[model samples]
Target: MIQRRLPIASASLLGLAAALSACASGNDLPSADTAASQVTTIGVNSYLWRASLEAVSFAPLLQADSAGGVIVTDWFANPENPAERVKLTVSILDQDLRADALRVAASRQVSQGGGWVDAPVQAATVQKLEDIILTKARELRRQAIAS
Candidate 1:
């Protein structure tokens, strides 16, 4: 009889420990409503995202994903340079509006034998675009803060 009571007491202690641990784990997790409230318009900086779109609006947009913070533009040819065209891809890599968080890649193509051929894109071109976008993003952020 004493042995049976001891086993029951040990089992009860084990169950209580398990229950306390479960409650602790639950406390560490956020509720669904809390997560929903934290959602934003974009994954990266909003000022940078909007400024990037405005800067690239001159070109035809092929894809834009706010969640992924990527913008791809279709090949654009200038009337002055009918033989050469450029395609641009912009990536917003961070939630902060920092220079390292923005990346610009340009693809250049030149007409060769009535077909488009890949050409080396100048590093300066990509850097200039990035600078322009960053400047615009800073300006937008400033305006928002002032207002």
Candidate 2:
């Protein structure tokens, strides 16, 4: 009777193991194609965040928060144009790499009488910056896929 019971228990254990293996298959995981575009490991899209940093690397960073998705740059004055200075604020609005997910704001100042005075930022200038950042982000994503 003991020998018979041992064989029955072994069969039961084998059946349970097979069922568990079937459940562990990884069908629910995201596909490689979609995974790159939807990456949010750092609260916002990683590609966009990196591209924004690269685009404004010329200026000193005043504040950078990954979780908040905001990057602020200190005043940067061109060497050729010492009389004018500009500051930049870049915000990542969403976790996707879409055109509408990014916002760029600029503050301009002109040296007047040895003091700085606020000046209007050109709309075209802001638009161009946004375009650059978006293009860089896309390129980064493509590189990620190629690798």
Candidate 3:
């Protein structure tokens, strides 16, 4: 009875391994016939890229590079708080719609008499901005899929 169980377990394990190996195999895309479909791709996920641009459109842009998947903004001063200003950087790390793929950094400065001084930024501010970007990305993706 023990010998019979051993064979069954071995067969099951072999089947699992085969399935995983098949999944790991890459698509045969380099063939001449498939060259047209293999256009160059942007470094980051498309939805996230568009959404990040839209979210920060209010701020003046310093640099935007789709191939590098980075967006840097010029310092923006709030009308209500003329003495404080903030600059934002958005980095997209992967070509997938995942929370870990997006990174948001903010730098805050306040006027100290005549010179601008760096100020400690609240963690919540960064997180909230990330959430907004993610939400917009999801919406954009959904719309794209529907169309």
Give the number of the best model, judged by lDDT: 2
Off by over 4 Å in 1: 1-40
My TM-score estimates for the predictions, one after another, are 0.72, 0.78, 0.72
lDDT of 3 by residue, 20-83 (tens): 7876787733445322211226767877888899988989999999988899999999999999
- Between candidates 2 and 3, the one scoring higher on lDDT is 2
Q: Quote the positional error of residue 7 for candidate 2 in Å.
A: 45
Deviation in Å, model 1, residue 62 alpha carbon: 0.6
Root-mean-square deviation (CA) per prediction: 10.1, 9.6, 7.1
Per-residue accuracy of model 1 over 1-147 as CA lDDT, tens digit each: 999999999999999999888878866664453222122457767777888899889889999998888999999999988999999999998877789988999999999999999999999999999999999988876775566
- lDDT of each prediction vs. the true structure? 0.85, 0.94, 0.85
Best by TM-score: 2
- Clash pairs, candidate 2, are none
TM-score of 2: 0.78
Winner on TM-score between 1 and 2 is 2
Clashes of each: 0, 0, 0
